[model samples]
Target: MHKNVYTADNAAMLLIDHQVGTIGWTKSHDVEEIKKNAILLAKIATAVGMPLVLTSSMEDNAQGPLLLELDETAPEAFAARIKRAGIVNAMDDENFNSAVKATGRKKVVVAGITTEVCVVFPVLQLLDEGYEVQVVTDASASFTKIGDDAALRRIEQAGAVITSTSQIVSELAVDWTMPKGQALGKLLNLGA
Candidate 1:
């Protein structure tokens, strides 16, 4: 597989700060929709046997814990939830960065709450480190539509792929005959 392509062999999923407190404030997308997309992404990643990393910002305080659906859907064996002290950017936290590096995959499918901050910060850094990054736009949210739009623009300007959850799932599956493909299609209600 080409390094530039986000095949299952080369891509991993990174979720950040999808907590109740932050999600409740999201204005760019419907809160329920964000939760659904996040859960769907997690389920797809799990079904495809992809490496997954999760992180939360200030979960002990205002952020609350990761959404229960994600927590339950993400595979425990293939996923690691990094506990950061106070780093807003998961890439800055040693544990989170190490978890991502340990995945041995260069392309990351990333999503998070507050697209302008938690999601974009680490995405820019990951791009700087020469990793191919794709941001799952629907799986992430911002305080306002303007904030989400601007953040996506910044990420694209930095050379990251700005894509949607369904697009990523399709790219990973490639063919409906494959078991992962069938599973993903069902999860996304695509009826493949």
Candidate 2:
């Protein structure tokens, strides 16, 4: 497999700051729909045996905790929760950065709430560090449509591929005859 391509072996999934408080403020997409997408991504990643990282900004305070469905569906994948003290970006937190590095996969499929801040910050930094990053747009949102649009444009301009949840799952699965592909189809309700 090419190093730059996103395969099950080369890709990891990172979810950042998808908390109740933050999710409630998202105006770019329906919060319920985003939740479903996020959960589907988690399930698909877990089913495909992908390395995963889950993080929250200020779970102890106003930002609230990660959605329960993520934890329920992919408990093991929810391996790390970097509770940032004051860092606006999860990449700025040492533990989060270290967890990502430890995965050893250079292609990261990432999404987060409030696209401009939570998602973009670490993506740009990861791109600079030479990771092939793909941002799952539907799995993330912002306080407004404009903010979400601008953030996605900024991420694209910075050279990250903007993708959707199903696209990521298909890319990772490769073929329907494979076990991972079969599992993904079932998980997505596409019928095996």
Candidate 3:
């Protein structure tokens, strides 16, 4: 497989800061839509048996905790979620970084609550560390359109693939008759 390409076998997922308090700060995309797309990523990871890591920042204060639906969708990942003390950049948190490294997959699919900071910071760091990163656009949002658009441009310029939830679903599904494909089709109402 090409280094730029990501498949279920070669990819892992890293969801950052999808917390209740932080989600409301998002104005780039619909809050519910972001939640749904993020959940879809979790479901995709679960269906394909891909490794998934979830991280949150300052849950007890303002950030709140990761979405409960994410926990319910991919319980195993939720069980091992990294609860960061106050790290804005998840990759800076040793536990979060270690968890991502433990997946042993260099191709990472990432999504987060805020596009400008929460999503962009670790993505840049991951790219610097030679990881192939794909940022799910709709699954991550920001406080304003300008910030979100700027962040998307910045990451794309830095070599991370700027992609969408539907694109990832399509890339991973491949065949509608397969289990992962069928699961994704039903979830997205693709009529498989």
In terms of TM-score, the best-performing candidate is 3
Q: Candidate 2's residue-wise lDDT over 79-167, tens digit each?
A: 55667775888898999999999999888999999899999999999999999899999999999999999999998999999999888
lDDT of 1 at 170: 88
For candidate 3, give the lDDT of residue 73.
96
Go through the candidates in order and give the C-alpha RMSD of each one to the true structure. Answer: 1.6, 1.3, 1.1
**Candidate 1 C-alpha lDDT tens digits along 91-123:** 999999998999999889999998998999999
Order of models, best TM-score first: 3, 2, 1
Instruction: Report how far residue 173 has shifted in candidate 3, in Å.
Output: 0.6
Residue 77 displacement in candidate 2 (angstroms):
3.3
The lDDT values for all models are 0.87, 0.88, 0.91
Report the candidate with higher lDDT, 1 versus 2. 2
**Ranking according to lDDT, highest score first:** 3, 2, 1
Best by lDDT: 3
CA lDDT of 85 in candidate 3?
Answer: 93
lDDT of 3 at 21: 96
What TM-score does structure 2 among the candidates reach? 0.96
